[model samples]
Target: MKKICLIASLITVFALSSASVNAQYYFFDGDYYENPVLYEAGVSVNAMNSLTDLGGKKGIGEKFLKDLNLGYTSISGGIFFSVSYKNAVALRLEGTFGKVSSDDKILAGINDAAKNRFNRNLNFRSNISEVAALVEIHPMYIFVDWPAKETTPPRTSPYLLAGVGYFSFNPQTKIGNRTIDLQPLSTEGQGFAEYPNRPIYKLNQLNIPMGAGVKYELSPLVNLRAEVVYRKLFTDYLDDLSTTYIDPALFDKYLTPQKAANAKILYDRQIVKVAGINGKRGTEKNNDAYFTANLKISVIIGRERIRR
Candidate 1:
């Protein structure tokens, strides 16, 4: 009976020791997921470009990045606040301010395929202000090897994001020394009784933003990131040129005399105007889009909790 009690006590001691060791192991090396909430704030500098009807690379205008013109790249900036879970997924609210412009004259004398665009003589610049809510997923974070506590989340992570955004733009063009707002001119006879099929587009619209990026931890509290986000827009009028040219006389019937005069010259800037109604002003098949490449710096905020 004494021997039995001694053996049982040894077993109890061994079990207790194993449990204690496991708790310590998890506390020191495997508690990365303990935090339910994490906060971060950041700012970014961006290079902006637009895929519109105005300017493009030589050849017939292509779709997406193939038609990008480097000369028109502009600068933009943004700020963001985010909340993350287990370092694997994040929800972010971001605001961006920027300018985008393009000029078809860039394609002048490039090729026969680009002649029509060069002769079109359309150009525009617009200020962009956007607010977006996005979800970012870090796939690599879930596969972390967790070799040690200090290296659990790794120093670098690649992420993809998709979100909806609200943006406003006012397309403007320079005529001589004067800047003209294109939307108010009803350039394509929009909202005019003569062109019942064409409706005026809103200056503010919703867009879908999707992109990928990579982040590197510069320190425990700071991170550096680079990303390219493409905004898919639903309107072709972002550059103030879409559909066929309206007869100049139509402007007189619908607009004030001063506006009518301005519209006549701004709507058709070509040296040799294409006669009649079928002259294509801009391609209507695809909507316009813009993209930005950003370099960002972020700081982690809020207290971190260590699991017990």
Candidate 2:
């Protein structure tokens, strides 16, 4: 009986040892793991547009492609710097340069909203540039391989980002053979002692950027990204239209004789209105916002992740 017991114990030990050697264990354990710095630098091309009181139909604003027709889309480009950890979190420094514009004239024959907008006939173009610092979170770990490899992560990921930035803009418009800078003119009664309520607006302001995106590894060292981001602004004058029309004469008081005439013509292009009355030109209830669709390519370089 003693010999039989000894044989049984030996068989059990061998079986357990074989299983331990053959079994698969791919997940990380509580053991010390070292995550090293990973860096990526990239350039992007984006298409951008703005939503303001100047353009779009009078109703709940539609988003994405639905509102594309309302905005005059423009092209932009920028560079990005990134530092990532375990492929889960990233800090990005972004510098973007772009232009945005809106024209009420585009509304012609589109809807009744056009009539009011056409009569208002306000249009503007602004060159904008900004630098932002953002944090990104990627929640789901998607895999390109059945078992993740050491020093490698999933080939694709989706992430969300939010951050604040400072931006500068100069609004301008083409007045036939001439180009007019709109901010100095204060077309909507801004900076007038008579309309003391309207304060002069600054060219530099803050913006909050929020957005989501997906990334794919085109190769071991190269990645591709497509993202859509919207920047919320506190100022309504991005397009230089945010308040009531001032007496056209105010232009003469504030600008040169030649500039005064040009400002008056650009201020109120109303094809139709009560001849004697200057109406509320725009609403200040809501601030302006802009969105961008970006395509980016990046190269990944860094120390490999290690676990022991």
Candidate 3:
């Protein structure tokens, strides 16, 4: 993570330096009618958690799961540099980083044997990180003007943004004497039994980001922004858990009657129930979603058009 952060910082610095050199050619030559350079930094509070009892038979109750929710409301900060052209359009480069967690009492049900087998404690704990970049457009701001004479300034400017970003996440769970990886729990049945003493998962994913927000200009050079974004991930194992109990009919198809009965006992305490989209367990789907809200402050670096 530190290496990734260092690389991001270098990229941002290079971009700003390159932009500064290019700005003189466009602005000094009077080739553009309007050009406003902006730089911003701010912090955000993230209320991130999951809905419980998402899908199963003999699963955690919906209300109990919801109430046992655990996660972090963290303050994330970022820096953005952008340029507005002709007052009608703009382009921005932004990088944001924050910490998020998924802790819940649902982990408490795992027995000592299960914990030893999976190498995780199953207790609620904070363990995750996030980073993203976005390209934004300021459409409605074309009609709004900054107040130059007012003692109190206007506090809002609505805008919309859509873009793609790369993300890296590390989710972990505690078992007994050691902390184990949970992302692999989804596919544990395949080859996990062989490695009973090691961490089971190393889950990582790429995220697709999109959202909208409003900005308030605090001064000619500084502004505040509040935005909400939904991230669509390419993986289905964010929770690093699963519920795979065998139904009589399901077992009848794959196992002999005697084997089926034994399998029930083996899985009785092994499966982790996940609620479906419709609030019922054992439905067709078994995936989850992630969302976030960010607040930021930015500064205007330079804004002036020179005569050719």
Task: Judging by lDDT against the true structure, name the best candidate.
Answer: 1
> What is the lDDT for 55 in model 1?
81
TM-score of 1: 0.86
Sort the predicted structures by lDDT, highest score first.
1, 2, 3
lDDT of each: 0.81, 0.73, 0.46
TM-score of each: 0.86, 0.79, 0.55
Per-residue CA lDDT of model 3 for 1-308, tens digit only, reads 56446546755674565556434322212232223344444445554543222221123333323433343445555555555543234455455555544443334555442232222212222333455555566665465443233222244667777655555555455444655443433222312333243243345445667778888767555677788876766544455444332233443444557544433333323234342122221222434445667767666555453445
What would the per-residue lDDT of candidate 1 be over residues 1-308, giving only the tens digit for each residue?
34334533544454344333312122212323323345679999999999999989888889888999989999999999777755677777788999999998998777678888888888999999988877899998666634344554567899999987889999999879999999989999899988887898899888999999999978666889999999999999899987888788888998999899889889988866663575788889989999999999999753333647
Q: Which ten residues in a row have the lowest lDDT in candidate 1?
A: 22-31
- Off by more than 4 A, model 1: 1-34, 144-151, 303-308
Model 1, residue 101: C-alpha shift (Å)? 0.5
* TM-score for candidate 2, residues paired by index: 0.79
24: Cα error in model 2, Å:
22
Across 1-308, the per-residue lDDT of candidate 2 in tens digits comes to 34334533544454344334422333322332223345678999999888877667644344434544534889999898777655666777788999998887777775554567766677888998987767778776423332355533556789999887778898888888788898887787688788888898999887899999998978645779999888989898898887777788888887888878877888878877643335677778878888789999998764333444
Model 1 local distance difference test score: 0.81
lDDT of 3: 0.46
